[model samples]
Target: MTNQNILAVDDATDRPRISVIGTGYLGATHAAAMAEMGFDVVGVDQDPRKVEALSAGRVPFFEPGLPELIEKHVATGRLRFTTDIAEATAVSDVHFICVGTPQQATSFAANLSYVEDATAAVAKNLTHPGLIVGKSTVPVGTAARLRLLVARHVPAGVGVELIWNPEFLREGKAVDDTLSPDRIVLGGASPAAEATMRELYALPIAAGAPVITCDLPTAELVKVSANAFLATKISFINAIAEVCEAAGADVSVLADALGHDVRIGRQFLNAGLGFGGGCLPKDIRALMHRSKELGAHQAAGLMQQVDEINMAQRQSVIDKTVVAAGGSVLNKRIGVLGVAFKPFTDDVRDSPALNVAAALHLRGAQVTVHDPEANGTARANFPTLSYASNPLDAAIGASALLVLTEWPELVDVSPESLGEIVENRVVIDARNCLDPERWAAAGWRVVSLGKETVVPAPAVRVAALV
Candidate 1:
């Protein structure tokens, strides 16, 4: 009754009530950000434990600035979490579906069951007409299907209008990306739905983010296309690294020179273990699966190559080690630095570095691994592998060291110092993370992915000979 008074009296100051379904990284952030924007946000997820945790102002995962945002919003009573879909639908004027579309267990296809179920719940619970927007990365035609899904259900007086507003949030920077996005893409079945979205996103648009409107398919494609392009760029450079290795050139310099071209500006073009994480690998596979279902099998075939190239980077590193170790890791002591798929993220889904380290272990190398935040996850995934606290600890007593994930600490590690730790002087820069000249000057051997190795400097070479 008291709540009715504030909204009933001041429509001008009223932000539209919004419900965000799902409480994964994306939903949690979205719900919090909406609350930060002065909207009352009800976050819904089937995971009652997650709902409880979030309702108590706890973030399940680490993102740089998310915990503060969640705390601020939850303290204000503007954000809440629940497993109850009906209550959320009744209380909110808009619904956002932000469920995870994980890759299917046995196929390249995405298991869209979570997304479809969320949509159905929204449709069933609606007793008043409201706009239900999808903030999930879904297949192109999924928006149309969801619209039909919603229209078929809900109360007689209620109608569900579908809107597609695909989230382009990067994992580590999701909060910033959501509130201050570079651009916003909104698409739907009707002009009215698009207009409603425009109104909803007006805050960010007014703050200078471009809001682009297109068809539902285009919005969906925007997310997958961006990931695909990034994955392709990484694989492209990694492929170039393979060529550079054969030709005796440095991929770092090559990437630098080629990046000078405006069309191919330097971004995700680092020649390393290629791309891996929750998003890129899964989305690309899902897109390929969808493309085949759409009868565009030929068009989707290159993704196989893309994936093959990416996977091959891991094997290539192991092979390089095999080459360095004289064709066998039978008694090699290999230290691996960094295990996250990428740095600054705790997520280890499809982490290439971890995979490489495990493979090396399985092939008989004594693999020691280290990562700032991903160590626990890596250990959980591969308990047999040894973990060290830092770079020096990982390198100490090792026959060879490999820089797998490019953590900032590894970038600044003094090779001269590392030379003192390893039993053998060999170091492999799997992420092309080391300075060859620095290592060469430090009396240690260095190898970079997609590039040739640098032999030990004069004094170290003489010592090895002696």
Candidate 2:
């Protein structure tokens, strides 16, 4: 069937009305972007609090530029939030499932119950011909299973087609990524669905975003595979970082030289606290779990090692902090900077920086943490640890300061000023973001990963002439 027949709507422009299910990070961004593209968008979620917040032009989480965009659309009346699935299905022509498929509590495999529930809800609530788009990252073959589930749930004689259009959003740049993605992937899209999607994404396509159309399984694999490859690249450099430290070489310099090679781009080559957040860690583990299930043993093992190396970097940071704190952190004042996983967003899920701080606190250190945008979120995650609003406050009376996340605010702090307040002028640059010379010149000892520690030379005592 042609998209015109499937997407019958009252608007004179005939644009497909959009309903994004599950208004977390992915869904909220997508719904707002669709509205920006001149499509009336409704975001559906079971959480009344989330709906109310979005309706009031307030975002529940921190993502750069998302709040302003949401506020603009909300004011223009092109976007809205609702908790009623039936109302959304009745009004919208395209339903996008952007729910979370987080790692299972007991296993590494993805917990797909949310995706299943969202799909079933959309399928059962259909009042007219509509298209279902899957934007959540899932295990391969999940699309086919969901297709069957949709078929069983939708009312008879209703035309409902499902497609997978995986989302690749960085936490900090989610707004820009959604509005102008690097590429668009459409999986298992029938000609009708593809046509509708092409029209729906007319803006990005016009602005030169490449689109790839493929079968369902390939589309499902694309998201996880991309995440896995990025995670592998990070782990690869971090593995080399261990070697760099042992060989008395610098990994940051090594990574710079390696990045000069076009084949190995320098994007994820930073050998620091490795990678953490909502996506990379869980996605890699889920990929490994799925690979093993599919009997791809070698692939699974590689991912296992990648995960191990990434996690090991966290312990490396904690160990370095202990050494910087005079062999132990017991009752020592440890100041931590940057808690959000990578920075620019207030998401602390599995944040390496926060992890290190919590570990230090557990070891009897008095921990004070700070972040540009994530202090509140970090406090929620690790409440027992003390939090400071600014970097200097975190450094007050600290025995050792650790820069975990590479936020510019933390990286660009004046070492001389920090020196005056810190009890012991020891700083561990776990992210390799701080300048060792600057800190050392300011009478501070700088310990960085993948490099030798830099310490200020002791002053010689002058003998009085008799």
Candidate 3:
């Protein structure tokens, strides 16, 4: 009654039929990617609306390249959506639990209700042998706990094995990350489970993605620890940016110089409005909470500072905006560029950009928010703030433009065009995304965090010698 035996009984085809439970950002993308990998994928969700959207070859969420992939697979009949978990379990040999582990309403701990419920649903319907893979980010001991839960709920004749395969997908680059993952980590107790995971990811493996096999706890720790490190890296640079502001040093220049050192490669060295969105902030807090529960108070203390520093970044932006508006933004129109946490996705969960816009609006500033893909979600999140159709619309008649999120369109925005629309030729690069020299050349008074305002002197007027 091993996982291999279960697969043998259920899947007669060359490729295993995969069921991805929970069709949010993670599950939907995983299902489509698995389908593209040649497995007939059934995406399961409790929400009928989401299923209908996917069934119609439309991605409910905004992810670059994911819609096309889902459409391609759905058109070819390789991918399908379902609201019935039992129906999905009946057909699939492997179930990937991609449910969300959001932060608890009253605590810093991760709420694993979705993960637990998904596990129970799949386990209850496992009439045949199946491999259950946990792709959700959970507490370190969750996989072990879920293994026991699955064992208890699985039917008498059915064989079920649990494996922890934490997903490391960034919101914007999920498709590329899945199709050609940097590395794949599989944590399982049995050889059958590991072998099955390896076989499942054979395409990515053959494409040169490294596979790391480990114990359940280690695998769970890897995901949280990676996020924690990234959060810390971001906060570390932001902390330095704070010093740079006080000491009159340029953080961008410092980061560029620091990036040259192979030991301190600058991946998360951005010193902007700080890290937010779904993963970094919540994952770090959950890690800290879990560490405290495990009696590691010192480690938790360090992460607490990281969280504090990240939060401080948003306040710093607000303070700077207030100063830019002559100590009050009351009745002043402020343009906000980019409301999504980052570019190419519409996720605004705890987005710093939206938070700043909301804060400004609360302080009586007329905030007009703009984002390439996230305006809809941002508007939903912050109804008080007015949304614009485009960057120029956001900047039109505004006193000062605030570049909050580093969308590529916002990054490459022409200051001249923006200046022509705005009442004041003032631009605040809160995200440090725009080139200060370019804005200066375009007759803008450019302001950036952690850098002195050095407007290039208007090209020296040369009087013709008659």
Which candidate ranks first by lDDT, i.e. highest? 2
Off by over 4 Å in 2: 1-5, 10-13, 457-466
| Clashes (N, CA, C under 3 Å) per candidate | 1, 0, 0
| TM-score of model 1 (CA atoms) | 0.92
- In candidate 3, which residue ranges exceed 4 Å CA deviation? 1-4, 10-13, 456-466
Comparing 1 with 2 on lDDT, the higher-scoring candidate is 2
lDDT of 3 at 259: 95
Q: In model 2, which range of ten residues has the least summed lDDT? A: 1-10
State each model's C-alpha RMSD to the native: 4.1, 1.7, 1.9
lDDT (CA) for every model shown? 0.83, 0.92, 0.89
What digit string (tens of lDDT, one per residue) describes model 2 on residues 1-466? Answer: 2223566556647778899999999999999999988989999999999999999999999998999999999999999999999999999999999999999999999999999999999999988889999999899999999989998898877888899999998888998999999999999888878989999999999999999999999999999999999999999999998998999999999999999999998889998898999999999999999999999999999999999999999999899888888899999999998888987999999988899999999999999998999989998888999999898999999999999999997899999999999999989898899989888989999988888889988888999999
Q: How accurate locally is residue 7 in candidate 3, as Cα lDDT from 0 to 100?
A: 70
lDDT per residue as tens, model 1, 1-466:
0111212212545556899999888999899888887788999988888888888888777677888998888899999888899999888878999999999999988888998999989888876667788988888898888777776776565555777888888878889999999998887536656655666677898899997888888989999989888888888898888898889887888889889999999887789877888999998898888889999877488777789999998898888888777678877888888888888877889988888899999999898888888888889899999999888889887877888888898888888888887888888888877788888887777877767778865652345554
> Candidate 1 regions off by >4 Å?
1-13, 189-191, 460-466
Candidate 3 accuracy as TM-score: 0.96
lDDT by residue (tens digit), candidate 3, 1-466: 2455757743355667899999998999999999888888999999999899999988888999998999999999999999999999999889999999999999999999999999999999987788999999998899889888987888887878898899999998999999899999988747767777777889999989999988999999999999999999999999999889889999999999999999999789988899888998889999999999999998899999999999999999898788878889999999999988888889999999899899999989999988998888887777888988999999988888899888888999878888888987778788888889888888888888788875756778899999
